[model samples]
Target: MHLNYTVGYIIPIVLDALKDTELSGDWWDIQPGVVRLCGDTVEERTKNMDKTTRRWREAQRFEILSGWRDEIYTVYAPKGSPFFYMERSAHPLFGVLAYGSHMTVYVPATPTTPLRIWVPRRAAGKATYPGMLDNTVAGGMGNGAGPWECIIKEAGEEASLEESLVRAKAKPVGFVSYFYVRHKEAGGEAGLLQPEIEYCYDMAVEAPDSGGPTLKPCDGEVAVHILMDIDEVVANLKNGKFKPNCSAVLLDFFIRHGIITAENEPDYLEIYTRLHRRLEFPTR
Candidate 1:
């Protein structure tokens, strides 16, 4: 659908299903290569869309919207433009761009130890990517929260990190952008496109004896937090143990830290380009 620009694409399955349903309201217009919402203002469009999506969620007809997270994500038209808000679960159905923040918390190498990162395993019963290894702190930017705000909230909730420590130590790095096609492994209808951007951060903590913050699972969303050596993290990434985007974030961290350099990695340039991929769609 073209808002200010092409905000999202209604895939074939979703399009056919939508066509079968009664599009009674003046909510949307579907054309050959364009789908437009009738509402002129952002508030108007959001209201109309939210009402429609609520109906879809309640009806339980659309498989993509079946497991409603109840979290609302702000959609951007091209980039830095607020378009409207949608339920997080329905984002893939429309091929919308998703944004989140991931923070890597690590202890620097000392004379007795190598640099190590705190990695969390997702709770097995979670709706998506359960039991997968993830960045130390990660959460979607929902309800209009910015990256730093999101990280601070997530750091405490997911990793049991102190807000004061996070606020004082978290360093905003760059981001990792990618175009991903969801597979069955992602626990939903396969082949849905997700052009995503992850705002990355790094937090370097002192060893436990030095009075640094320790990480533990505060919420049930994370099964456990494990501090692992850098080499172990590399091995896990090689084996696809981390969630796809989490792996990407860790790789971005490696590149930023000069651990994966042109001299050591053959695809250095390609990796750099892929990590900072320019999205065709608008972003916030």
Candidate 2:
């Protein structure tokens, strides 16, 4: 995929931060200023990067905690093992697009029924993408949690779902990946490099009238829960009403469910390939 000029510009800044670090990789001319950390083991990489992040934090004064939980996410090898740890806030500056997972719960459409998906509205005061539409339950993979673990925790925290229910119903379908470069919010400060991959899941839920399970925002992250028909969801996606990354996940859902197909979408192949772009990172 072709990146925009902004992403091209930020690549070198992230590489420069690694100068003098013990990361074992060619510093210069590695994919045009992109630094790939090659390490002997997870422990070694984690220790080295931890020191790098601390020094970078002190030297740059970058805000350390900026997410919903102000947590630290373990940077992982492509196979999903911990490589290092870094504060969520500093990820963008380093061009490290952290991995996350989310689930979309839906009532399946039958011959007589219509497909409907659960969408959550982020709280207006969210530090990022406030008031935008999001998946039913979404959270980043932290230092100690894998994708499944993270989703279960997010389900309970964001939607008050019981672990037993989520564990029983959620199925790991696939993933949607994208690279986004965000410009600075104000002034001339550097912008963020966000290359994200969402491990997407799907869960079948009882229809609203049946009251199979009630979804309420147990935490302050969400403002409300909404059940919208698949058509409406697609419309919102086209209108850019959903969070950009969330939109990619929803589009993947539609493609998998046959709601979108090659015959209908002119750019089906391109969209399909881009949604699962192969990152340089190791992913299991």
The whole-model C-alpha lDDT of candidate 1 against the native structure comes to 0.85
Query: How many angstroms is residue 89 displaced in model 2 relative to the true structure, after the best TM-score fit?
Result: 1.9
Which pairs clash in model 1? 78-282, 78-283, 79-282, 79-283, 80-283
RMSD of 2: 5.9
Q: Which runs of model 2 end up more than 4 angstroms from their true locations?
A: 1-70, 77-81, 183-191
The candidate that achieves the highest lDDT relative to the unseen native structure: 1
Q: What's the TM for model 2? A: 0.79
* Candidate 1 lDDT over residue span 191-234, tens digit each: 88898999999999986678877688988999998889999999
TM-score of each: 0.93, 0.79
Write one digit per residue (lDDT tens) for candidate 2, span 31-114. Answer: 553444444665655565566655655565344322324467665544555556666665676666577998999999978878
Report lDDT (CA) for all predictions.
Answer: 0.85, 0.72
Evaluate model 2: give its lDDT.
0.72
Where does candidate 2 have its weakest 10-residue lDDT segment?
A: 1-10
Model 1 vs. true fold: TM: 0.93
Candidate 1 stretches greater than 4 Å from native:
1-4, 23-26
